[model samples]
Target: MTKTIVITGTSRGIGFELVKLFAAEGHTVFALSRNDKPVKGLNLDNVFTFSCDLNKASEVSEVAASIKSQVESVDVLINNAGQFLKQEFKDTKMEDVKSVYETNVFSVFDLTHKLLPLMKESTHVVTISSMGGVQGSMKFPGLAAYSSSKAAVITLTELLAEEYKENGPSFNVLALGAVQTEMLEEAFPGLEAPISALDMAEYIKDFSENGQRFYNGKLLQVSSSTP
Candidate 1:
């Protein structure tokens, strides 16, 4: 069966890789991103692309409307869109914090709430979280806003999972560690030897397909040493 999948932030990074993987596997992939540029090398017939700034609630509503018109049920939803502002609490502007929350937390909640009605029983919803979400990192400086937002996402993921546990869909948060992506570069420049996006995508694909059965309602960590 060709499952209907929705993935956000498909313009680049792990989200882009995930869209390609799912689409190539013959699943219907609705790839959402701010940029509508053509994805090179994705020749799959099952892929559909949409441009929506996740920071705006109205744009999210528009995307939801379009999805409703075409797809009846979403088998999986990957909330992979996020923001990270690596500034100290004292130095971080209020606007930057608001923007981070809007991108990392608020938009995710809004989109999930709107599209959740379209999800059937046993549908899987995954959110890309960070290891920083689990415990506050004293080792790293200047990431208070980013880390806090991700922690909020982790909480939201757990709440949603419990809310839908008995009769509806499943939800899980993937707390990834040190993935070598543009976000990493933006957050921590000059850091070397992070996990590749392809490897991260493969891990995510496997988890989405099989790991969800056991790990639903849990925060699964993915790192270089994680098995």
Candidate 2:
């Protein structure tokens, strides 16, 4: 059976990899991102791409409506669109914090809420969190806003899992340590030795198929070193 999946932040990074993996496996993948340009070098014909700035609640809503109109249900939704802004507390601007929260937290929540009705029982909702969301990562400097937003997402995932455990979609947060993505390049110039997006995508594909049975409602960390 071919499942219909929706993946945000599909222009690049882990989300893009997920879109490719699922589509390659014969699933209908709705790839959403701000950039509507077609994915290059992908041979899968089961993928559909949409362009929308996920930071905007209205835009997120529109995307949800569009998906609902096209597909009766989405078997999986990967909320992978997020922003990371690194600035010292003293130098951080309020607008930047708001923007981070809007992109990383509020927009995801709004889209999830809007799409909840389109998910049937056993549907999977995966929110891509960061290791920074964990308790011990406070030592990382200049991550206050981004980390806090991810923490909120963790909480939201937990609540959603608990509230809908019986009859609604399952929710879980994948707290990744580090992956070789554009975000990592922007965060730490010249940094190396992170997990590859393809590997991470494969891990997520397996998790999406079975992790809920063992790790649903909990934060599962994934790193290059973890096997």
Candidate 3:
């Protein structure tokens, strides 16, 4: 069966790899990103690239409407778009924290809320989070804004899953560890991660396709390293 998967932040990293992986498997992928050029460059027939900034509520609504118009049903929604903030707690401004939340937290809610009508019981909503967000996980400094924002979505996933448990899509979150992506490089300069973007995407692709059967409303710690 060819699945219709909606992935955000498809310009690079795990989301970009996911677009290629799904398209190669003959799945229809709706790739949303600030810059569509990377996914567009591939020119895969199965992939549809949309230039979108999740932080913009209007853009999120418009993209959801566009997706609904194109696909009758969406099998998966991967909330992979996030804004990283690496300032110290004392130095982090309210505006900076809000900006991070705009992309990492609020946008996930906006896009998912709009597209949720097209989802079915069989559909899966996989949200990408960070290990820094996981409760009791090893914590790191200079990530107060980023980690707190991630935690918000983890709880939101649990709430949504329970709310829609009767006849709605499964909602789950993956609290990821260090992955060697540009985001990681930007966050922790010169630090190398054991997992690559493509490898993590592979795990997520498989999970998005089948993890719902075993889990829903659960936060899986997909990490091998500390914060």
Candidate 4:
């Protein structure tokens, strides 16, 4: 009953906690990140580490090839790696928008496309998004680029679901509220959040396991309140 799960962005935050959560459950986990070292104190036998910059096409392809060689099928692929930027639309640099999209949107698409061959019937593809991405939700002053990039991720998730649902691997995006993580602190310094990365990781664990049964091509907002 141990599923083979591939998770990206395990260097820290929710993705790091997810590696621990899945490995503790005895699932075979492939943890991908730019950092070469595994998370501190997580040396479980079931966790395999791969160091790759997801924004780099060659590195992503190489890592995908290596994973395909080792595992015939992957039960879940969690595209949790993302970048956030804080700048008003007028002041935002084009380079910042492109950079955020490269990591948050294009990288997710690239990795998922490469790993599609390894996914079978009923597999799950969950990508992390943000509450700001949800239309008509709370609006922020300096998150134009970051929010739009996440919006693209949700749209991409819908299209992928339509394209691949018949074969396997239902696609979904989790638009999350503020979580207490380094990323959050970077975006909004000194703000306390209702949820922590570890709490989000626990919710994502259950969602990754049972989401396809009730939801696919859906953007499920994970937040306790408007943030």
Candidate with maximal TM-score: 3
- Clashing residue pairs, candidate 3? none
Clashes of each: 0, 0, 0, 0
**At residue 130, what lDDT does model 4 achieve?**
94
State the lDDT at 166 in candidate 3: 95
Q: Write the per-residue lDDT of candidate 3 for residues 1-227, one digit (tens) a residue.
A: 89999999999999999999999989999999999999999989989889998888888888988898999999999999999989878887999899999999999999989998899999999999999998898888899999999999999999999999999799999999999999999888999999999999999999999999999999999988865
Task: Go through the candidates in order and give each one's C-alpha lDDT.
Answer: 0.84, 0.83, 0.94, 0.91
Model 2 per-residue lDDT at 195? 81
TM-score sort, best first:
3, 4, 1, 2
Total clashing pairs in model 1: 0
Report the error of model 1 at residue 112, Å: 0.8
Residue range 66-166, candidate 2, lDDT tens digits: 88888889888888888989999999999999999998898878888999889988788999988888766534678889889988999999998999988
Off by over 4 Å in 1: 38-43, 136-139, 225-227
Better of 1 and 2 by lDDT: 1
State every prediction's TM-score relative to the real structure: 0.93, 0.93, 0.98, 0.97
The collision pairs in model 4 are none
Model 2 C-alpha lDDT versus the unseen true structure: 0.83
For candidate 3, the per-residue lDDT at 38 reads: 96
Candidate 3 regions off by >4 Å? none
Comparing 1 and 3 by TM-score, which wins? 3
TM-score, structure 3 vs. true: 0.98
C-alpha RMSD (angstroms) for model 4: 1.2
